[model samples]
Target: MKSIKFNRELCDFCGTCVGVCPHDAIELLESDLRITDKCTLCMNCVYICPVRALEELDEG
Candidate 1:
């Protein structure tokens, strides 16, 4: 399966990823962004993150 990897150190909570996600799979909480099961590995979040904080990961 494909998943997302978050680099908390690089994230700025800019909400770009959350806005770009078509599946509405990304959410921003008080302190962090969360990826839910609805995610389709669409790479929208990965590409939209300004800080490159989100990455696509392959998990077989």
Candidate 2:
């Protein structure tokens, strides 16, 4: 399955990835972001992150 990975060092918690996710899979917590099982791996979050903090991961 494909999923989203967060780079905390690069993330500013702007919530752009959460806002852009079509599946409502991304969440912006007080301290970090969360990826739920609802994620469809659409890559919308990955593309929308201005800081490039979100990454796509392949788990085969």
> lDDT of each structure?
0.88, 0.86
lDDT of 1 at 53: 96
Model 1 lDDT on a 0 to 1 scale: 0.88
Clashes of each: 0, 0
lDDT of 2 by residue, 1-60 (tens): 777789998999988887887888877888888899998888988898899998988998
Over 4 Å off, model 2 = none
- Clash pairs for candidate 2: none
Best by lDDT: 1
Sliding window of 10 residues with minimal summed lDDT for model 2? 18-27
In terms of TM-score, how similar is model 2 to the real structure? 0.87
In the range 1-60, model 1's lDDT, one tens digit per residue, is: 778899888998888888888889988986788899998888988998999999888889
